[model samples]
Target: MTTKHLNLKFSVKDTDAIRNMAKSGRTAYAIALWFIRQGRPVATDEVLRVCDDMGVKVRKSA
Candidate 1:
């Protein structure tokens, strides 16, 4: 599958790609958007910072 980036550097985890469309659960996109809404979604590290700051842990792909 091809994902069109929003000019955002951070890459969402493969696992959270689909399940993150909503806010009911924690996912990469959801977490990233949370930062974008805060006016800080330009770099990959920044995106990761948002999730880390929020204590949302992304699972590692095997």
Candidate 2:
């Protein structure tokens, strides 16, 4: 069996765009998934903060 992992990378421009989207009321999950689709790593803290500021409640899974 063989396993491979994705190497996520992002540029300054990408971060800026993500931040803009976050500020514009985009959901954290949506934004994070967007970066994942592009093979980029999203900053979790930033996303969580944005969600908090925008009153996006994150549900806990059991």
Candidate 3:
């Protein structure tokens, strides 16, 4: 089996857009996961901050 990995990188504008989406009721994790599936995983801290700023609660995984 073989695996491929891609470094997730986003510009300031992209981060702003993601934050805006979070403010519009989008789940931070969902946004992060979307990027991840596209081979661009976002930082967990960044996502969590967005969720917090937007007053969204992220359920902890068991």
Candidate 4:
């Protein structure tokens, strides 16, 4: 068996926000899995909606 490598880039701010939410007692896995179940995703724009609902503050980046 072989494993493939993939690259994913998230802004420093978004990474920080994810960390903060975890620190604040939100289960990161739950958020991700919930979106997966909904056939949505963790894409920035989509995730931001979840973040906004969870009151997660995100710094914008392009």
Candidate 5:
């Protein structure tokens, strides 16, 4: 099989939008880590709840 390349173009507005989204994702990841480090089920539950509220779907890979 041959490798395929994809071409994508982002306008200024699109760049800004993705930047904000990436920033939010980073913040969410940090908060989740903090919750996990608390060693409390409640904290972890809260993190899952927030993720659900934000429509984040996680799947385990085998």
Candidate 6:
């Protein structure tokens, strides 16, 4: 199996968009669309921050 990876940095506007999507309860959709549009992944930490802002609990893997 081959795993493809990319290193990406988010712009100010992109960060703002993530937060806005989180606030509007559409974080997943926003992130997915961004990936489809840019062919890159958003920062995982940015996603976690959005969850934090929404008070969503994230559990670690065992």
The model with the greatest lDDT is: 3
Task: Give me the runs in candidate 6 sitting further than 4 Å from their true place.
Answer: 1-8, 28-33, 43-46, 49-62
- Taking all chains together, the TM-score of candidate 1 against the true structure is 0.31
lDDT of 3 at 61: 22
- Compose the digit string of candidate 3's lDDT tens values, residues 1-62: 11132213555565566667665666666777767887876766667655455455553221
- Residue 55 in model 6: shift from native, Å? 9.3
Q: Can you write out model 6's per-residue Cα lDDT over 4-31, one digit (the tens) per residue? A: 3231454556556665665566655456
Q: Identify the leading candidate in terms of TM-score.
A: 3
Q: Show model 5 residue runs off by greater than 4 Å.
A: 1-31, 35-42, 59-62
lDDT of 1 by residue, 1-62 (tens): 23333424444552244234323454454555665776855444544444444455653221
Query: What lDDT score goes with residue 56 in model 3?
Result: 55
lDDT of each: 0.44, 0.54, 0.58, 0.50, 0.38, 0.51
Better of 5 and 6 by TM-score: 6
Which ranges of candidate 1 are over 4 A from the true structure? Answer: 1-24, 42-62
Tell me the tens digit of each residue's lDDT in model 4 across 1-62.
Answer: 11132214344454555657545655555545544665756654544554554456544342
Model 2 residue 1 CA deviation (Å) reads: 44
TM-score of 2: 0.46
> TM-score of model 3 relative to the true fold?
0.50
* Candidate 3: pairs in clash: none
Q: Model 6 residue 23 lDDT?
A: 58
lDDT of 5: 0.38
The clash count of every prediction, one per candidate, is: 0, 0, 0, 0, 0, 0
* Per-prediction TM-score: 0.31, 0.46, 0.50, 0.37, 0.29, 0.44
**How far off is residue 25 in model 3, in Å?**
0.2
How far residue 7's Cα lies from its native spot in candidate 5, in Å, is 40
